[model samples]
Target: MSTFIDIHALQTLPPSNINRDDTGAPKTATFGGVPRQRVSSQAWKSSIRQDFSESLDSSQLGLRTKRVAEKVVKQIEQLSEGYDKEKALSEVAAAFKTVGISLAEPKKKKNEEEDSTLESGYLLLLSNQQINRLAQAIVEANGEKLKKADVAKILDTQHSADIALFGRMLADAPDFNVDASCQVAHALGVHESEPEFDYYTAVDDVVKEAEESGAGMIGTVEMMSSTLYRYANINLNGLVKNLDDSEAAVAVAVQFIKSFITAMPTGKQNSFANRTLPEAVVVSLRDDRPVSYVNAFETPVKESAEHGRRYEAAKALAAEAQELSETYGMEPVKSYVLAVGDLKTALEGLGEETNLKVLLESLSTDLSKVLAN
Candidate 1:
C-alpha cells in the first residue's frame, strides 16, 4: 500500500504577471469553456526549490546546472590543498568520463586565457554530498584515474532532499535518473479571468527640462488578479525510499507543505509586489490514494453580493470534498486545515483547523506514526 500526502491551497494574488509566456503576458488556460489565469507547475516547483535553500541546510540540497564539472573542480581544490585549478579540472573531467558524462572541451577566449571550466552537455542534478564524495575520491587517487564503478556508485546514492522530492533525469546517462516522488498541478484561477494591461511611461532621470520633452520609455504589461486553486501530492513510500530514512522523509514533507502554501512565484514581483498567503489550506494523509479537489472550480466560482471570490472558492472546495467523501467514501487517515477570515467559516468540517506552526508539528508526528506502521 502506498501512503500519500495531499496538499491543497486556495490563494489570492493581486494584479501581477507571476508567470508569463513568450509574449510576456500572464499564463492562462481554458477550463469549462472559460479562460482562467494559470501558473505553471515548473514555476511553482522552482519557487519551492528556492524556498528549500533558505530553510534547509546546504549539504542536504542539490545543484542543477550544466557546470557540474566546474563545481566538482572547486570541491576538489577545497578537499586537497595540493590540487590546483588546472589539476582539479583534469581530475574532475576524468571522473565524469568514467560515468559516461564527457565534459565539453575548454574554450579559449580572445585574450588567450584558457577557460579551465568544463561544462556538460545538459544540466545535471547532483547532490552536494555526491560532489563532496567524488572530490574526495579524486584527492585520494593522487593523480591515479578513478574506476567507472566507483564514480557511478558515488552518484547513484546519497540523494539530497530536493533531488529526492523533485527527482532528476540525466539524458546522457539515464541510468542515474531518480523518479520524482512529488507531483504539482499547475495552479488555475477559480473564476474567469482576463488579462489587464498597465500602460505607463518612464522619465529619464538624467534628462533636464529642455533636454527631453517626451518620456524616455513607454510600454504595456499584462497582468491579472485571481483566486487560484493549487494542488500537490507526495508518495510517502517513494520519498522514504529515495531518502533511505523515514525521519528525514517526514521532515522533507513538513517543509514541502509549508513551502507549497507560502512560496510565491517572483515574476514581476518588483513591479507588482503581488505576494500573498493562502486564504485556506487543506492537507490530508491517506493510505488509499491522494485526492485533488480541483474539480471544485470547474464550474467557475462567482462572487456573491456579501462575499468575495476567495470566500466563494473556499465554500466550493469544501463542498466538493464533502460530496466526494460521501459518494465515494474517500476519507483520509488524517487531515488538517488552516484558513483565515470568512474562509475559516466557509471551510467548516473540511478538517481540524490549525495554524501553520501547529499544522506542521502535528503532521510530523502523524507522518512518523504512519511510516512506522
Candidate 2:
C-alpha cells in the first residue's frame, strides 16, 4: 500500500518584503485574473533546510557550496595533522578530479577578493557524513594515489535527509543525481494584493544641520500584506527508499513536519519583522495521489460582513478540500486539522481536530506503522 502526506496552511502577514523580485518589489503572480503575492518554492526550501539544523542531527543534513576543494581541505587538515596546506590542496584536487569535476580556474568576481582556493565552478551539494567519509579516506590513503572508486564509495548520499527530501543534481556526474521525495509549492496569497512603497530619508547623527541641509540618504522599499496559502506533499515510500529503509526515517519525517510549521523565510526580516505563525493546518494521509486545495482561492477569497479575510479563506479551503476528495474518490487513510481563532470551527468538520503537538505525535505513529509493515 502507498502512503502520502499532504499539508495545507493559512498564514497571515503584515506589510513586509519577505521575498522580492528583480525590480525590488514583492514577488507576485497572476491567478484567476488577479495579482497575488508569491514566495518561490526555492526560497521556502532553503528556509526548511536551515531549520533542519535546529531540529535534527548534523549527520542528517547536507552542505551546498561551490568550494568543494576548500571544504575537503579543512577536513583533511583536521583528520591528518601536520599535513601542509599545499599538500592538502593537492590531495583534495586529485580526489575531486577523479569524481569528474574539472579543476579549471574560474573568473574573478567584480570586487576581486584575493581567494587562493580552487573551486568546481558549480554548486556541489554534499552531505556532512559524505564529507567526513571522504576526509577519512583521504587520511587513510596517506598522500598516496587515490582511485575513482574510493571517491564514489565515500560520496554516496546515504544518511542525508535534506538531500533525500529536496534532492541534488551534480552536473559533472549525472550518476550522482537524487530524486526529491518531498515536493513544495510556492506560497501564494489567498486574495489579490498590491505592493506599496515606503519612501523616507535618513539624516546622519554626526552631521551638523548647518553643514548638511539635505538628508544623508533616501530610499524607497516595496512591501505587501496578505494571507498566504502554503502547500507541500511528502512521498513516504520514496522517503523510505532515500534513507535506505532505516528506522530513523520516521524521525526525519516528524522533524520535517515540525519545521514546516515553524520555519519562515528571512528576507528583509530585520527591517520588516514580519514574524507570524500559521493560523490553520490541515493534513491528510492517503493511499491515492496528493491533492492541493489552492484552486479554491482561484477566484480570490474576500472579507465578508460576518467573517474577515483569513476566516473566509479558511472556510473556502475546508469546503474545497472536502469537495475535491469526494469528487476524486480519494479515501484518506487518516486526516487531521489544527486551526486557531475562527479557523478552529471552519475546518473542524474536515478532519480530527487537534493541536500542533498532538498532530505531530499522531503523524509519527502513522509513519512508524508504515515502516513496520
Candidate 3:
C-alpha cells in the first residue's frame, strides 16, 4: 500500500454561508495580502463524517459525545436485570473510574428541562462495539465491582474508524489518546474573495396594513461566492493500525474519499440552498511524505482572465503538481483526475482519467493489494 493517500479538489460555491465565523459571516483567511473565503477544516471534516452514514454501515462508525455515561447506562439497563437509571448511572460511573474518566453530574442549563441524565466531564470517543462490551462487562461484574483487568482489556480493544481517522485527545488520560491519521486543510477560494451582505426582512400578515406598515423582522447575512480549493491526506498504515483491520481500513479510505469529494457542508442551507459538486478532483497515491498544493493559488486565479474560476483553478493545480514532481524528483506512484465540462488541463497528463465509481473501486483494490504484501 502507498504510505499516503492525498486528495485535492476544486469546487465552486455560490453566495452562501457554508461555513461561518463567530460573527455569523462566511469564514475568511488572509493569503497573498488579501482576504479569501474559507471553509474551516473542522467544518469540512464534520461534513465528511456525517456523510459516512450514507455510504458506510453503522458498525464502521464512531460516536463523539459528552453524554457517554448516559449512553452506557442505557446499554447497561438493557443488558443487566433489575438495573434502573439511578443504579445504571452508578455502574457506568464505576466503569469510568476504571478508565480514569470522571462521571460528573450533568450540568444544568437555564433553557433545559430537568432530568437525571449524566455525562463524562469531557467528550468520549467510542465505538458501538466498545460501548456494548463495556456495558456487558459492567453487567457481568454486577455494577461498581469491575476489576482493573476488565477495564484494561476493554480499552485495549477499543477500535473506531472515526477515532482512528480523526483522532482523540484525552487531557486526563493522555495514554488513551489516538493520533489522527487523516489531515484536512481548510478549504479556501481559488481567487481573492470578499464577503457581501444580504439584507432581508419578513412581513407579518396578521397585522393590518394601517396598524403595521413595517416588517416583522429585519437582518443581514454575510456571504461569498468562489471556487474553493480543498485538500486532505490519509495515512494508510496508521489507519489500519488504529482500526486493527486492513480490509476495513481500505473500505473506510474508499468511502471517505468518495464522500469528501462530493459532500457539502450544510450551513445556512435553508437560507441559501447552495450545494455544488466539485468542478475537478485530483487524487495522488504516493509512498513519500504528503504535500499540500494549496500554495498554487497564492497569487489567486482571476475569473475574467481565466474564463471561469474553476477552469483556471484546475490549470493552476495541475501545473503546481507537475512542477513539484520535477523540482523534488518525487512523482506519485499513481494519480487520478475527475473533472467536469471542458475544464480538463495538463492534469490529465499527470494521471489517468476516471469517474468517481471507477476511482473508488481502483483505489480500494490497489490499497488491499498493498496491504496483502
For residues 170-281, could you state the per-residue lDDT of candidate 3 as single tens digits? 7776777888889999998888889999999998777655577888889899999988899999999999988889988998888889889888899999988998898888
Going through the candidates in the order shown, the clash numbers are: 0, 0, 1
Q: What local lDDT does model 3 show for residue 356?
A: 92
Distance (Å) between predicted and true CA of 349, model 3?
Answer: 0.8
Q: Tell me the tens digit of each residue's lDDT in model 1 across 267-353.
A: 999999998999899999988888999999999999999998899999999999999999999898888999999899999988999
TM-score, prediction 1:
0.95
The 0-to-1 C-alpha lDDT of every candidate, in the order given, reads 0.92, 0.86, 0.85
Order of all candidates by lDDT, from best down to worst? 1, 2, 3
Root-mean-square deviation of candidate 2: 1.9
Off by over 4 Å in 1: 106-114, 205-213
- lDDT (Cα, tens digit) per residue for candidate 2, span 1-373: 7688998899999999988999889999999899999999888888888999877888888888888777888988898788788787888888888978766456788999877688877888888898888877888898886899878877765759998888888888877788888999999999999999999799886685558677889999999999999999988888888888646777787788888888999998998899999999988898889999999999999999999999999999988988987888876788898888878888877889999999989989988987688
Q: Kindly indicate the candidate among 1 and 3 with the higher lDDT.
A: 1
lDDT of 2: 0.86
Ten contiguous residues with the weakest lDDT in model 2: 205-214
